[model samples]
Target: MIRIRLGARGLGGVRFAVSPMGSAKDLLRLVGFNPGTLTPSWRSRATDALTRHRLGLLAVVGGGGPLGYAPDFLRPEPPAFLTDIDTALHQIATTPQERIRYELAEAVNGHSWDPGSGHPAPRQLLQALGRGEDHFARRLADEMARFWHAALKPSWPAIRTRLEADVTARASDITQYGLAEALNRLAPNLEWRDGELLVHLRTDSIHRLTLDAEAVILTPSVFVDRALFCAGEPPGTPAPRTPLIVYPAAKVDCLPPAQDPLIGATRRKLLAELSQPRSTTEIAKRLYLSPATVSYHLQILHRAGLVTRARRSRHVLYQRLGGMV
Candidate 1:
């Protein structure tokens, strides 16, 4: 468990933003290498992309340590708004040498490497980085750019749309329902109580941190199936940086092709049924279709920008977008 005490400054600074590089990194970490929690289609796509791409260094870095810890320099803190991939990559490429060496050391030395664990390349790379090889950073950035182009860029438009929608809805929640409620609703693993936000991490260790004046950035990712918190600054850093909470965007697993044809009568009926927010089960019961069928059509409609989804308690409520009443 990670406990964060959000003081007034931290509370006021809590804001939402979309990070392209963050999502790409998470996709590489969770989908490309780890491969669980994603839908079948998404998993297949990621596997195919990884098989086709030559992302050697990226694979090693994103493969993570025994503790599932990726080097933090790969995902720099994003701005308080949507940023393009180019900008994020540049930040990684130009990271201060000391921070790079420190983080790489942490990632490498913290784990016990074996021959079958494919530690040779990483060990060599870590040695190179330790010797102040500036090219390593640029090489990492280049590989990440290649991976993004191969795996994420093709579907980025739809992914970005979903992330933006999540940010908009979360911002509205913060405005209307208060930040505590919004925090509680982010995921099943998070809770905000008595001026402190509690995050349940996969690790059993407990970490307590005070927000002080540092901001809490809420970033939404379509690739991350679970909530992740990137907190604390690298050791020996000059100043503390903002902490980030990367949560799974609602219904991200249901993303389909953005240009699916909506000619089916069932799709039309489903759209009409969404005159009010309804769940898949509700729509299936109303239209006499299986819940699976309703979910499939809804995924298509959502990708086509014709519908929006929100998790209301345990049910995901779908509604028609625009003035499509």
Candidate 2:
């Protein structure tokens, strides 16, 4: 369990921003490491591009499994609401050598080195980073740029739209309902209780963070299927910066037209109705459509890898995949 205690000042300082590099890293994770809930067609295209570009360094740096540890320096908190890829890459390329050393050491300490773990020669990479090598960081940045263009750039507009919608919805929730309600709606694993935001992680270890004055930046990502917490300052940072919470955005109405031509207006409406699990009859009643029509569209969407269905007692429930968009 990871509990973040946000005082009044910390709560007031909470804001939302979008990070391109963060999404890029998540893209890498979806392609090179964990597929999570990504659609088959999209994942296939991204895989082909990754193979064509031969992003060796990126594969090593970003190849950690879904729950594996990666260096935090790879995705720095964006300074603005919408940070372009160039600016985010620059921030990574110019990371101080001391911070790089510290982060690399932290990674090394957390996991044992495995030569065949899809991470090619991580020890050598760490050694290069430890020597205050400028070229190492530059090469990393260059790889990230190439990877972004190859895998994520094509779908960036749709991705950005989804992230923006999530931010807007959450912001409105904060205004209309309250911060606590907004926080609880972020993910199923997160909860707001007693002035603390509790993140129920897969790990058994417990960590408590007090946000003294540092704010929490809520950044939504299309590739992140779950909530992720990023905090703490690397060694040589000027001061403690805002923490980041990268959660999955709602997965409706963000698909590029080229990606799925089958998603017509009716299917789109059906998808929106599936923000939560529902039965065919329930969806039909809500959308004012016949159960047969809803079932037909749901079957098409299920075949396209956009939704999943499972039996729940006497009824079957369908829900949209988290990373479909």
Candidate 3:
């Protein structure tokens, strides 16, 4: 369950400090108990704050990003928060004791896609061990590696990627508690105040943090804009890119080599014919490529949720899904 100390009388009566860079709605949701009652501006303001953020440490909400590999997604049925954790641990302990394991996982399909009916709770899942008859030690280390870095998983592809993906997914209207959701989802052990989950370097509360925060995010549904505990002064006046932005670019860059030349050309031909509904063969011929190549890229795009297909006249028609803007 969400944790936050509340006051009597009203949400305003609740006395606490808030982090600076979180969704105002997350705070409002915690204090006001109204996720849907928030105004559209609340969502818009939250998005603006994220985009304006210099350090890019904010979390993603409302569906955005590569969708590369969300380990959390495993099945369609989700369990209760506590139940999910319990089951996850149980699976790790009892599932034939494989060396490698998936620490964070989620269900694959949703029973329905109702508003507020998107993601199931954390429980309601089956855990299966990895298959490998040999190399127990190697696999064990790999499994532990994921667990050790589990906290970072939710913030993957850099915080920017997560934020971007979230924005893209929910471009129209939204009720997202960005900052709180990010902290809680990324690292749930911390307490909540003003709707932002405390994710300080120090495990202690904001008061105990020896150093200042690198960043703070406010959520939607707010104007008085509480939650302003910055780590320290920003050297001078603030700009878009706050604090500093130095990195071991060459040391940690993990992007794969640019797309293969042949694959790249094939991709272009597929896109050109996606205007109206057409089968892979139709597009392939227009681009002078084989149906097999078109089908492969189509698979990738579909998995990316970019292209949609339907069976029309007993033949599948692929249409370019146009949500990414």
Number of the predicted model whose lDDT against the real structure is largest: 2
lDDT of candidate 1 over 188-280, digit per residue (tens): 788898887777876653444444434688888766656787745533453345778888776522323331344266786786787678999
Worst 10 residues of 3 by lDDT: 243-252
Model 2 lDDT per residue over 1-325, tens place? 6667788988987888988889887776666556655677568767776678876666766765333656666787789899888888998888777666666554555432344456444655666565564777888898888888887786676566557756876777788788899899888888889988777776653444444434778888877767877755433454345677788886665644533466888998888888678999999999999999999999988866667676989999987754354
Report the Cα RMSD per candidate.
Answer: 8.5, 8.2, 19.6
- Residue 130 lDDT (model 2): 58
- Candidates, ranked, lDDT: 2, 1, 3
Off by over 4 Å in 2: 65-67, 111-124, 130-133, 204-213, 233-240, 253-325
Quote each prediction's TM-score: 0.73, 0.73, 0.24
Positional deviation of residue 311's Cα in model 3 after best superposition, in angstroms: 2.1
Better of 1 and 3 by TM-score: 1
lDDT for each residue of candidate 3 in 1-325, tens digit (9 for 90 to 100):
2222223322232211121112221322222223234334333433344444421211221121122112211110112211223343333233232212221221123211112454442221221122331332233223322322332223222333323333332221122554334333322233456633343332232233222223332211122112322212223322111111011111001112232332255554565467567898888888787889789998875655445577978789886532111
Better of 2 and 3 by lDDT: 2
